[model samples]
Target: MTSQFEYGSISSLQEIQRLGEIIQQCFGGSPNDWERYLNRIGAENFRVLRQGERAIAGLGIYHMGQWYGGKILSMAGIAAVGVPPEDRGKGIAYELLSRAIEELYQLGVPISVLYPATQALYRKVGYEQGGSFCRWELSVASIWLQERNLSIYPVSPINYTIFEDIYNQQAQVNNGNLVRHRAIWEQVLEPPKEEAIYAYLIGSENEPEGYIIFTQNREKQESAIEIRDWAILTASAAKRLWTFLGDHRSQIGKISWRGSPFDPFLLLLPEQTAKIIDRMNWMLRIIDVPSALSKRGYPMGLEAELHLEVRDDLLAANNGKFCLSVSEGRGEVTKGGKGTFQIDIRSLASLYTGFLTPQQLQLLDRLKATQEDLETARLLFSGSHPWMADFF
Candidate 1:
């Protein structure tokens, strides 16, 4: 029996254009703009489910890495998922994602992450909420700091490498932040159409401790500042950056940026005036279970063992008993265990990043574990709160 639909890498520009139209139909973006984006991402990075030459569903895959426990783990970033209105009920999205993760596993991508358009569909494929992407808003007038002790300089295109270095240094200490791909950097440095982006380094030229990249939007009587990205390595840097932003109080109404829930920059603020305007939970899937466990960093000097029976309906390789031994700030996985603690792959995704504790998962009825095991699991995965400043 021949299946009605075929799945493969998008083979031609015409198929790419058709996929762009399908995405536009689902996401409400200009087809031409999406077409250009698809071209830039390259046909090789996309997979589609097709009925003959017409694509019914599709998504793009980005090869990237994410930070966890101060280590970089290989990750697949899924984006642009789309299914035409008429094909919504046919299980195309599930089949497409199912095939994608299987391929990712074969390619040694230990994990996958995505910002979902809807959570239910991803849950079916063993993905769960793993971390937060929070949007913070602060009234420009609220920042009254006037510290100019550290010199600030405008960064030219040639000085962009410093920005990359500073960001990686900060990402190392945080969980779930991206080890950004070059494509992401391109988007960061490129100014929007008819708008300008300013990049600056704070502190002395020889030893810059922080950087800020932002764009100003002036709409007649109202104006705002959008922080594209920033990082601070010193106490004075935070105050200096805030002072620079406060300088725009006369013109900029508010400043907004996507960041972690426990952003250290907030600690330097004189008052708690910064409000979280938006919050998003990004999902993660353990594509290759043992590899995922081994690649992630564990808490140093705290050694313990967890016996897990992970259930995965789609990936048989992950559906078995395993022993996770943690030592020297790393984990090693082996087959066969008591299977004392049991959880499906979805619940494990959340626990893997420390986004939710084993206790919380049990409270939600997402897992079955003893109080003793829960405490052991908690110590093994404990770290900074999992959050990302990047979107997709």
Candidate 2:
């Protein structure tokens, strides 16, 4: 517990080998996986916490972005947060997180998000649960696909633009969704030799509004379709897509969908043949309060003016009163105002992302506001409950 932890990027193959073994022991990965990962993302993007020459914990910093308030905000997606079993109960994770967040803010990332294995450490570090990554399993026959004049065509990697266009359209209306980097799409279009994924587009050949990518696996004469990524522009298109999924019912016993947290598949099902299989909540932290507020998209018709007293423990620059004025669906955040109520970085993130409304936060004692202020904040921060479809 009293060990002097040194925090920095991994420097050598020996350190990479050591970190990989620790990862295998802690989270299960190949001993040499770190070497390959470092090669892909570069050594500087990965960090480690060491005592002397021994690594105790490590994490990777992914330069990512997410859709929030109708705009894409730069995000630091924390990945591979691992601590050796023997290193647990120590402060290594806290130390590593502190360094990672500081670096993210310095790099001008307005927000940092991650899928937390546990809420305690992240909450203590000023992160809050934002939205869930949900998956559902259903019998292929259960899908009620409404037949329409739908032209669905298979898409080849050569036509990546159509797929990206549809995906981009979906991300816009959904808060906390990812604004994927082109490198990711490049990989998707040209998956590794060991990967099997397929894509398709719907609508006119020149104008595709919906897309789906899926992978299949078989077991003992039964087959399952795992939807990798998909998006639709209309309910009719969605129904048409489901109809396409239903086409495999003769061969596919089940289909698993990892889509919007608010997926209406259940409502679309004529019968109760689907089950909620899994759900995982992703955490988000506000790195720069003013920046996050100003950059996020808001309801264009919403007009409001408010004051807030924000408190940030790790970032002193965010610890002060902020004046938030909104008009014509845009917002401006400044540094002075008679704060109506106070909120910490953690709680503020929840409210800012629409994961929790002002009333809910006040009831939880996370947001301090009266009836009027709460209503104003509610209107100012109103939007869909943020959900991230991507897992970092």
Candidate 3:
């Protein structure tokens, strides 16, 4: 027989360990493998559903920031949601979601986002559809390696500081870029294994121009190299960087890259058919609609106003409408009374990146606006693919 339990009371490390074991058993591994994950996301951020002495269901929360004019906090992210197989279809997961969302609301987290394994499941919980990421695969032979104007060298501890400086500059302008703290860099770049992350820095005139962090997988006797992070300041630099990767064409059979939906690599490869796979990585919501919208850079020569009615089932302040106006890289916000278009905050975030249009979101029922309002929203929110390179 199944039992009922309260949510959000999993406090101790022991309790978390017990819950982790349940996850491991159901999902096929020991939770100890996620120690780094647990540390990054503290146990206090998790909500657990316990029946008697046994923990059954749980969810994790993480924090992220959007670097605009000012920083927005309390951007909570949900992950590692699971319920035991025996307890499936009993509405346990749904109840846990409700309780977790309520707890996040109480904590004053303005936005809650998740990368749903199934998009339909989260929609029922009031999370809307966001834009997706594209994974591109290209054969090394297909890429024409340009003359190496710059020297490519392996990353070393000595040049870590210079590499970071160059990376930070690229990350700032790159929308959908994750702000990698020092801890994240240490964990990703210097893990404790032979399969540790490999990094390469491109130097021009003794100065760094680009860098890439990647790892090799040798499973199935086939060599597959996955690029974890890649950034170059110029197109020529990008070509030179890929040319370096092409040098390993004989040994490395396949190369995969993940980035914005408008990645230029797709345009570079004309001879071979590059496979593009669309997968949603990050889901963003406007914690402060006016501030979040106004902070992000928009396409030039576009001036318009949008009335956003963001329904924050968790946070009350974000549940109302606000008028947003932008022109010449400046924006203003007013009370959304007497507005032209109405959209939810989640929809607004999806539109923020220009990967998905207001009309497209409207068709998906993610945005609710009239025809004229939809046209206005489409005009203001449209831009090149907006994507964050990292999933924080």
Candidate 4:
């Protein structure tokens, strides 16, 4: 295991095929399946660590944005990090991730987030649990609602812009929802392989209030409805969509969708029959602290100033004291401060999303700050619980 390693982007199809084998071995997908996935995401985004001509570890970077405080912040979604079994426990993951994160910082990405297979390796690179991706399931038979106050109409690829408009309208008010990339949009709007996807508008085409993109999974033995993406901008639209889903109770037994822990749609249910069937916590790494602080939206008309002493072991530029001045729902970061609040970059990810309050991190010994600073930090980052309806 003393051979030299090269770390960089994949340059050839041979490298991709080799990396695809590693991915197939690590994750349980056929190489051709991964090849199609790689093609969809684009080969330019894939990076690898190589020993001679063979790729031992690799990962993919997806360019996207995350909504926070009514604004969209640029974020790199990291995915498909894989390594050969023989290469495990040799610091290969750490090396690949560190190089990839540095590359992101060099490219001026403000932050990077990933759905981690393991936290230890990501944590080593200053990534911490930033938000949640939860899958909720409800028995279709229990929906019991047939309200059709709003008109429902089928939407085709030609009018997919309606989905974007409706989704953005809902996303601006929530935290951590994706401002999806074109690749993600293509994946959502297009049917996969042999399966078919259905898209519909919840209101009239002239002024659509919401949209739903879903698929019906019916096998010989079982059937279920899987919602790919959805947004309800009005109460009537929500009722209509639920009724439409309930209409499928005759063939679909369960309906599952990705949503937040406290998804507002669940509140519309008359009873608590829906349950969280699956959940995954995604991690975030702040690549450029100042850009991250200045780019994200803040509470309007609330003026405040907070001094932070942040520590970043991986990125030197982020390791220092900084002052954040907020006004008109925007922040300006300047170097030098009283350093009243102290935290590491990893913990800041959680605070940045308002996923964890300053006090909670203080209690967990993840950060240290005085009571006054803690309250100020809380207000500076206050918002809905950070969660994503989409998983990268």
Q: lDDT per residue, candidate 3, 1-392, as tens digits? A: 22367776677777778778766765565455566666667666677887776677887776554333222334567778888788878778877876776666666564556767666556555565454566777666777666488787887553346566676676565555545544345545544346767788887647678888888776478787888777798767787787888788788877887776667655655465567655565565545565556666554677877666666554466667788787875567776665446566556666765657877887888777778778776666554455555554
Each candidate: how many clashes?
A: 0, 2, 3, 0
Cα displacement (Å) at residue 246, model 2: 1.1
Question: What are the Cα lDDT values of the candidates?
Answer: 0.88, 0.80, 0.66, 0.88
* Candidate 3 residue pairs in backbone clash: 176-387, 176-388, 176-389
Model 4, span 148-177: residue lDDT tens:
888898876534566888888998898888
Which tens-of-lDDT digit does each residue in 105-217 have in candidate 1?
88989999999989999999989999999999999998999999999999876345769888998889999989987667766766666578888999888878999998888
- State every prediction's TM-score relative to the real structure: 0.96, 0.91, 0.81, 0.95
Ranking by TM-score: 1, 4, 2, 3
Q: Lowest-scoring 10 consecutive residues by lDDT in candidate 3? A: 65-74
Q: Which one wins on TM-score?
A: 1
> What tens digits encode model 2's per-residue C-alpha lDDT throughout 1-392?
43587888888887777777776776765645555555655667779998888887898777878887778888888878889888788778998898888877787788999899889999888899887788888888777576667888876644556677778888888888887755455544543435677788887887776888887888567898887778888877777888898888888999887756677645666887777698888999999888888888877887787789998888888899999888887789999998987889999888888888889988888877778889888887787778866666
List candidate 4 segments past 4 Å from native.
1-4, 157-162, 190-193, 219-222
